[model samples]
Target: MPSSFCYKVLVCFLLTYSVQYMGFGRVELNAQEGYIFENPYQKTEKQTDVTSFTIYFNQKSSQIPKSDEVRLQSVADFLNQNRNYEIYIEAHAVDGKNYKEDILISEKRSLEVERFLLIHFVEEGQIRRLFYGNSKSPNRTKAHAALNRRVEIRLQQKN
Candidate 1:
């Protein structure tokens, strides 16, 4: 009887491990420490849990740069499938506008991202955090500033 009980326990453990390996979990969208926008578009033949994708932006560019259209589409697609997932749009900007005071460009960048998502019909409440006015990292350069100006999306874990 003891040996039979041990066999049952071993079987249960193996089954649980198999389920976990088979992508039987929810995907979590997470933001990296600094670069928030990770690969917003990842194609998976089999469904697996992805934490989330991050979308980076530019601070100096007065308008949305030309490169983001495709990524935006990816985000839209993801939301369509995962409507229950919550999002956080973090906006950031360079500290100085004209070598003087802070212009709060980060706020503008974040808002723009929100607007884009809104245009696609992602409801406002699904977005939990509309963080703004994040300072530009000192390591960023003028040419690379746009990379810093972005809104990131992260999934809120369920309670």
Candidate 2:
């Protein structure tokens, strides 16, 4: 019985030692460095004052295309770093025959952007959405009309 108890104790010690040395679910300690845990999935915080990002939409479509999807990552990264910042999302739509339809489309676009940001862990209270519809467009050309269909994200630091 004593030999069996000694074996169990040795097994427990080995297990603890292996866990500590292999860095499995254990934090490493150092005199100068204090405590450190290596996590590959950890997101590195960025320091930046950049406060604006624009996401353009295709003609007559509220969905964000794959090409422009990457732009949201920068916004997410910025927001992640600046917890005290509030986001202002302004969505605009191109002028169509029906004014109300334009407004609805703009609102949908803004909501989509807001949803994306929220999914990236941004707080709901930090987001303010505004839809400009077709009223704010100054350009009459077809090429520029495409430019009007966009969602602009502006970040402001909380006081």
Query: How does each model score on lDDT?
Result: 0.58, 0.77
Error in Å for residue 155 of model 2: 1.1
- Model 2 TM-score is 0.64
Query: Model 1 segments beyond 4 Å from truth?
Result: 1-59, 98-103, 132-147, 157-159
* Local distance difference test, candidate 2: 0.77
- The count of residue-pair clashes in candidate 2 stands at 0
How high is the lDDT of residue 137 in model 1? 50
Write down the worst ten-residue block by lDDT for model 1.
42-51
- Tens-place lDDT per residue, model 2, 32-128, is 3221223346322332434776667877788876534555766777788888988899998885567788899999999998888889888888889
> Could you tell me how far off, in angstroms, the CA of residue 15 lies in candidate 1 after the best superposition?
72
Give the candidate number with the greatest TM-score. Answer: 2
